[model samples]
Target: MKTKILTMTIYKKLTTKIHFFKMKIGINNNNAGIIIFLSVFFVSFNTALSVTKDSITYVKPNEYHGLLLNDTSNSIEKYEIQRLNYSTLYDILNTRNELFGMSLGLNGHYNNFLSYGAIDNNIELGINGRSLTNYYNGKYNLENYSPEFFERIEILKGSDAAVLSGHPNNTFLNFQEIIYNTKIPFTRLWYAQEGGSFISADAIFSQNFSKGWNFTFGFKKMDDRLAFDNMSTDYWNLRFILRYNIDSTSSLSISDNFTNNKTITSGGSDPEQSLNMYNPINSSPYYGKIQMRNFRHDLNVTYSKKMNFFNITNTTYLTSDINERALPRFDESDTLGNTSNTETQIGNRINLDFTFDNIEFKAGSNINTFNSEGTNFFTEYSGVNWNLYSRAELKFTKSTSISGGINYGDDSKNGFIGFGERLEHRLNENSSIYLDHSFISKNGLIYSNDLENEKTNLFIAGLNLETIKIEGYYRIVNSPIFNRLVNEFYTEQYNISDYQAFGGSASYREQVLTDLFDKNDKIDLRLQTRINVIVGNDELKNYYPLFTFNAGLNYMLMINKSELNIGFKAGLLDSKTAPRFIPISNSYITTTNNVGIQTTGLNIYSIMKLGNAFVKIEWENLLNANYYNVAYYPERGQIVKLSVVWSFFD
Candidate 1:
């Protein structure tokens, strides 16, 4: 699942019960056969494991009408894109709960994610509701798109996702982009082979030429070769969408997300010139000559209206970020220092909602206009960022509720604010429970001038059930924000002060072997389990790793129209001290100088189908262990992949 071609991703809430945009599981169309459930989204052969969203259309989990509702607290952790076995998007958001380590590799779109207490970039991303928060160096190419361009993935935690519009953050990673509302005319073709010399591909085309209009087109590509040693990578993506649903609540859209990146890095490696710290030594004396390039364009326009009372969404974007660096010159190592940088942005975002009965209201705003230029010894900056927010929710009964929020901004200096409170209960009918407290303030534009905002203090509790879930958290961050490293190349934005962390997570899923006996018209099974625990002090606990877990097993076999799928995922992350990547400011630091990581990872995949096409064969780490999240950048040992997706219907 890798091409976010022409890239443009949005929505992804496979099955969550919370509200506040972050749109992830919203297209259920209810009728029209939904093109036979979206042809399994790109893998065809459906024995059904997804594509069912009827509980009340779109918004789920706590069931609609945002105003701080989290269906009894699980702060959101949605990630389902059926039958997939990792390939980007931080591999299904790394180690799950609390997001633990992994960056500087796997295409380096960077995400050591653990925004619980401000860590460079502080996490913020969304689709549909706009805002992909890259604010330069916060990284968000989601590692060159895939997972078939998204259909699910939400990770909202803390600061209650700040009502999501970006800018205010503690983590809120959202997505949903598999633009469908087709009226036939579908087309899909894909290819992949990743074990060595890696290569991947995808091509898509969607429909609806008239009557309301809907169109989509996509293309994605990738080529890689690297495990360390000179390094290399190449990528491409192109996506397009045009929609006009002006009826049924209203809609209008236009999108384009383009990508092009080429790399040959040696930004790391030098664990004392490697003599086997599990093999590491890039020492870059100029080994690869350093070439890092990136080109991007995200042009968007959106409008939405749905009313009985109120609902409005507005998004306007124009972004272009270009970077080019060709090194080999710090004193002339043969003279070569080519630099090119261009950054442009024009953004606007808005979301408003209202409900009266038990009370609920939401409001949001975001504005941006930034510019940068370089080439000729680079250095040109510009800014203008704005934001506003509000939230409220009350319910005296019907299972209780309470919420509050406030946010204010002014990235051009002198203004920042954030606060929150929550309490909810619903302990029955499939469970619910929550408790929260927050105080956050984060300002942007690569900060550090006057330096004052980058604070966080969150405390949370959780419980949710239908198949079990649990959460617990405690956090404290005073200055936070860091990216220091001012002399081994370049890096800035520092704020360091107080830091503390706490954690908890529990999970369970069902359908294990279905009915347990008999009733086998070919079979289907499911099982999932999770656990995560964390504790921190000494500033960020070395970027987290106190015990992170995973377990999964899903199988399906329905041989007739052709079907078979088997997937299993296993995990464990214990030892820590992983952070030290900066490669000309890609970011990740936690100095005290050291490197170590304990690993136990596994991934297996299989999906087979014939007529309409489907084939996915995977194996990542599958026993060939040995891991690391930074420092010489290890991880990536046993790899195997093969994909083939086909579809074409008129």
Candidate 2:
């Protein structure tokens, strides 16, 4: 099969310059950590003596804009700063930096990070208003687009069957599009290089036209090597967005995203080599090949109107995706047996919202249709699924509220019903408590013939006390299915069983040492800590971690014209069953024993404003810990990135 490849001439030249720049800045391989620490301390110490600002100003909140799912009509400001910080690409460096109590694990690629114990199968990917969850025989690769392409990302921890018409156990990741609105044209160019042979470049252009019309376009390219061998990957992506406002209360938006990614599958390292944490070797003598090309388009129309007694809003969206992948064996020969898959999907959703007094109601319907054709015992299949849902929220008093919803869907082979309810009570101005429960039955995917429908029951309770929060949940699944290695070559086959899990997490955050300093103190200190524990049945325990702990401290200094932010973070993951690579499938299957890993790192970032231009420098993993989120795939060591943004009005 033919695959797309981006030119490497520019990338090679840029990396050479970046290496020289690193050396000129005194950031060599050795002593980089010490230099970063001293630099942060020195700047902070000097700035503390000449305080010019009152307090640290954190990143602005990405408000909970209304979604098409339900009509919860939340106060836009209610969720502002609910967490210590927002989720950004910086958080990808350390799981401890996650503010949503999520555990993120990465494979070799930056876009292949797994969330909540889910490999690629159990999690759903959404961009703008499109869903790329369906897969034929290949992996659902989310690494096609860069983080810079999205304005903000929102993670919904648990399942919301009524709102999200997909599998019940999957977590929801929503990537919001970057809306362009500038008086004058805006353009940006960015380049970054890491320790390894990893280089990336991006360009963005945006303009606003007359009568509330806007257009934005972006292009990105990346070339990265995963191991010491020739196991490398190249990716390219293009995105375009256009928006037109019919009036103040109505608008239409359209987006198109295209991506091409090629990766070399070397089967990772052997068991013995992986066991040695410090110096692992890729023992696989065979190198396979895999490539994916995806194109997605989304169109959304939204309108809102006010009535005498209530306000009504409607949102309708149409999304389509075409995906293709080719996988060949490790012998560098496609003649023996090569596999390929081509899938096309189209989905649409329409939602209506009505708000009156202290009650809000929502109704929505969705339909998804997909077809797949492939080789290697891959039969042609086509299917259409539809769902209908309704939900309502009522506030009895200022301090108490209740919400519930139900959804019904049919996937041709089976019917699914899901329902959920939640009740919340305010203990004080800074504290609240909530209880929630959900029961859902989900139909298997069209491609999985042997896997039967599954049902799950979940119960959760949580308390939020200002800077301290605690949450717990219990889940039980009937007829669950998971992939297991079937042979020494790491070929995976699906297995069906029942599973149960119980987990809880506690997090605390608070500022310290304020009283010891003067009234005009220039230094500020904040501490954050979190602990997560999960226990599963024997079958399920073999695939997920048992315990995770993270702690970090942040310091801010008020400089004369700029502010400095520095932080140190550390995380520990208790031993559990680890995964081994399956080259043919380009996936990982669980192994028997457990492998404990620890990660520690320091991050220093500074944001400076010079008239209309803003500059930021971020250094991640200064300690350069040698660790692996997966068994054999080693994570990136240390990285340095610099970004600048300039805005001007004509």
TM-scores, all candidates, are 0.30, 0.77
lDDT, candidate 1, equals 0.61
- Which 10 consecutive positions of candidate 2 have the poorest summed lDDT? 73-82
Give me candidate 1's TM-score against the actual structure.
Answer: 0.30
lDDT tens readout by residue for model 2, 512-601: 644233342233333443333334445446455566666666555444544444555565666656555554444566666566656645
Question: Candidate 1: deviation at residue 101, Å?
Answer: 12
lDDT of 2 at 144: 61
Give the deviation of candidate 1 from the true structure as CA RMSD.
25.2
- What TM-score does model 2 achieve against the real structure? 0.77
lDDT of all predictions: 0.61, 0.53
- Which candidate number would show the highest TM-score if scored against the true structure? 2
Which pairs clash (backbone N, Cα, C closer than 3 Å) in model 2? none
Error of 2 at 105 (Å): 8.2
Off by over 4 Å in 2: 1-66, 69-122, 127-130, 137-140, 151-154, 157-162, 167-170, 188-190, 273-333, 427-431, 486-495, 514-536, 581-588, 600-624, 638-650
